[model samples]
Target chain A: MPKRRKCLPCLSGLALLAGALLVAPVSAAPKRVMSLNLCTDQLAMTLAGPDQLVSVSFLAREPGLSMLHEEARSYPANHGLAEEVFLENPDLVVTGTYSLHNTTALLKRLGFHVEEFSFAQTLETIPGEVRRMGALIGQEKRAQAIADDFTRELETIAAGQCGKDPTMIAYDQNGIASGRGTLADSVMQAAGFANLAADMGVIGVAPFPLEQVIAAHPDVISIGAPQKAPTLGEFVTRHPAIGALPDTRIGAFVPEASLSCGIPSVIEAVRALAALRTEIAPCHGNAAQ
Target chain B: MKLCMSLILLVFVLFVVSLLVGPAELRVEDSIAGLFAGGSEAAAIIMREIRLPRALLGLAIGMSLGLSGAVLQGFLRNPLAEPGVIGVSSMAALGAVLVFYSGLAGSSLYALPAGALIGALLAILVLLAIAARQGSTLTLILAGVALSSLAGALTALVLNLSPNPFASYEIIFWLLGSLKDRSMEHVALALPLMAAGWFLIALSARAIDALSLGEEAASSLGISMSLTRFLIVAGVALCVGAATAVTGTIGFIGLVIPHLIRPLTNRMPSSLLLPAGLGGAALLLAADIAARIVLPAGELNVGVLTALIGAPFFLWLVVRARREML
Candidate 1:
């Protein structure tokens, strides 16, 4: 009877240890997070605690594509390969629903905790995404701070928009333009500018005719900066017809790598456009006012 | 004379049509006024900077290809000789792709013509050597096919290897040329080289006619074969290289135009050159116009339209050539 009583305490101790193991994952934040998508990489970089994010997609370091490319250098870069994920065995994996389809599936099948962010991001979704990434990485307070700042700043810019809404087109390489339902379109809207490509019935990223772009005579033509490597497609953006718009302001008004993704940092793009709007057509003594 | 006059009129009409047709639906009166009077700055830019360059490229590039094809067929004494069919255009495209994409000349449009000229020059030299060694038309054509396949594969490989992701998208442009978004800069880059090419080819007109009789007979006629060879080689290379540098590898204009015009002419190779050039300009302008009209948003590649017409014609020519051989 005394031996049974001693064994009872040991059995309960083992049960408590097993229950703690079950509860720990639900309570604690992931220590090692790997981001296999460019957009997710930025989110994780912005929200992750020190040493929390183990690796980011290699594209995160590319200055042309990543707004936080400078910060991305400190974190190790992954090529979004399944093999690397297997080797690294990060506690959490964040990727995009649009790409790395097989890797996402494989990771999920292998019983890894995977979170997917949608590629079709807009200004409205930015705060939600920031908070979600923050929650996932246990940086909710920091994420909430950034998310609130982005929302407040965006709202302030949108509120200041009045009077003349200058027409703009985010013309990219190969005569492509960001139109309706694109992040650039939403940014232009918040900045008090009409998206010319969207107004002309273009959807998403589509080839906007050069002649049409010329004929539209937008008040501003926002073009991408030339890529690090030269491309013939870049010439379309620099075509003389676009240059001939004497009244139209043509330049990379948006900061580099700012408009390519929908992150909290995209607030910078909206702020720049709003400043341009103030310069081009101020709200003071305007008809809309 | 009548054929030349008709071809001239056709080219003139097509040139105007090419200017008139575009994705922008400008009023005819407005377009003309914009081209000359600058009524609306937008219209003026579209007319001057956009449509004009595209139309001019269509005309000049077509002429270059046609003249080269006529000169090549006469010099080689092979009806099947053409820049695109014989892989000269493909090699020229490869050269341009390699030079421009490699940043060898720092993104200057001049790099395109420079590389293309060298590529076209090498191709012509190799083809000329093959033609000299084996007088058979089929052997020369087979060699051209091999060269074309190799050049095409290499062009794709180089583009794929480029550090710029957009460079790979240009593979289609390099393979199937497009005149979309061509500006005055492109015309400035290509026209002078092509004009020089035309002049050089015109210089060898009498020699190619003489060579039509046979290489031995031409030599006996006191025609300088070496000089003629140099002029023809340089001429074809420049014409095709410059055209391709701007427009990518636009196939079949060289092949189809000469054949189409030869029947209208007295069958003299020199006589075919002028008419072929004019006809080529008209056909290319028409094709380009069609390209703009067919799918106004994206626009079809001008090469796609030309190949559609030329590939069928090539098959027919091959069959006829085979029957003649039999």
Candidate 2:
């Protein structure tokens, strides 16, 4: 009877362990996800299967400014405020470096699993962010596939049009231009136009003189269309010299979503640049003489 | 009349040149042809759609600022008085910024101007309340300075707090002021308010001329001090608030243009208003053209350029004013 009683307790313990094992995987997979930035909000929607996401940053739904306005409409959105995020009881929270510091700290204090992504201004850092995001969501294979696709797109665009002449410059409206080490510079390079800015030996954000733009006589001028400023076209056209550039094909290029804010957008940006190469090539060839 | 006709002709000539010259370099004949047969599709788009509206808006905004500045300075009886100095511009800017950042105006085009006008009106009322008690030029100037500084500080703080990186850049351009990319919408919104303001200011011009002899002398001359003050303040507020609502804060145009043209009209505030309006129009148009041409594919703010040119002239005027006082 004593031996039987001991055996019964052991069996109950085993059963409890088995029950926990069965429930663990189901609960571990994030059913309720919260995104704390516009970039992450966009990524979550793209990566997470439908009906899995709980909330996105309020910025995602701003049609005038958000690149993913249409997609963002489906999710209940938060302002990325700590109180708001915590109230939702999300299984996973995705935030960026720019997310409110106090909110992030408080979430960690409460033993919540919070993942943070870095803001990438350059192309090289994109893959790491992708892998990190993949590991967090248990979508490592999908993430790897997306990363591989990004690399392939960039490589293809680079191989096809990287050698084309009549160097171009990515002029950000408001007198800002991308120098070396910027994703814009990478895009310009992939589009078959040398970055005249790179020739100045300056990296990151540098002042490109309007006189230099004239002197460089770039074969093409590519303007970056920031989502916030829709009136950028008006501002750019107001400059008499931009209007006067001879044989220059001036077009605003929307960087792919992955390249713009995350790993996925980088590939999209490359594809967009590749498409622009055809338009730029003729202008470059004509300007060469 | 002859001078007015010549100024009108000069404005017409400037307007024509502005329409003709742009980044695209359309010839005069081509532009005219474009205006009529709509020339080539691109040229028509450029002339009718782009340059015409920009130049007209520039003309209207310049006229409003210039005329309003003249009235404010004349009423205050102080040459240092300008729209920005009196808090109208800063308030309008703050209003515009609030509308832009709050997401209230995010979906609507009209919200920005409407908010800006409301801000301007609020600022004007505040200034009037402060100035009414003392009814002295010194008190009015002090009140204006305090309000202007507060408004500027608030703008800076709001820009700093905004998560959008572009907000600071927008503030810089707003402070510097420009008529570039202005559309007919701005003109349509601003013109009636400015015209009404101008009529009110013109009526107060004789009163301003009377006040130059001293406020008591002006009152003795049958100009009720309270009525004159009310009309002038209201007029200046309406004109400047409307102008800044659309164009942002264009500095020094009011102070410099009025002073520059004051001598031509024998320093009579009543006579100076019209020519000052014309001269203001010419000066701003010229500045706008310079802003466009100074850099290839780059433009300077007309306000900055004007301030760079005006500040020195202002210093000289101050030194002269001080020397005369001494």
TM-scores of chain A across candidates? 0.89, 0.77
Q: Write the residue-wise lDDT of candidate 2 on B219-259 in tens digits.
A: 88999887887777667767777777667777777878888
Clashing pairs in 2: A242-B297, A257-A265, A258-A264, A258-A265, A258-A266, A259-A265, A259-A266
Model 1 C-alpha lDDT per residue in residues B1-326, reported as the tens digit of each score: 98888888989999998888888899999999999996788889999999999999999999998899999888888888899988999999999988999998887888999999999999999987877556788888998999999999999999999888888999999999999899999999999999999999999999988988988899999999999989999999999999999999999988888887787788989999999898888889999999988974678999999999999999999999889878
Error of 1 at B173 (Å): 0.6
DockQ of every candidate? 0.69, 0.05
Q: Cα miss at B44, model 1 (Å)?
A: 1.2
lDDT of 1 at A30: 92
Q: Which tens-of-lDDT digit does each residue in A1-289 have in candidate 1?
A: 9999999999999999778744554489999999999999999888888889999999999899999999999988999998999999989999999998999999989978888999999999999999888877788899899988888888778777677688999999999999899999999999999999999899899999898988989999999888767899999999988988889999999999998788999988999999999999877765445
lDDT of 2 at A196: 82
Query: Model 1 TM-score?
Result: 0.95
CA shift at A233, candidate 1, in angstroms?
1.0
Each candidate: chain B TM-score: 0.98, 0.90
Give the C-alpha lDDT of model 2. Answer: 0.71
Clash totals in order: 0, 7
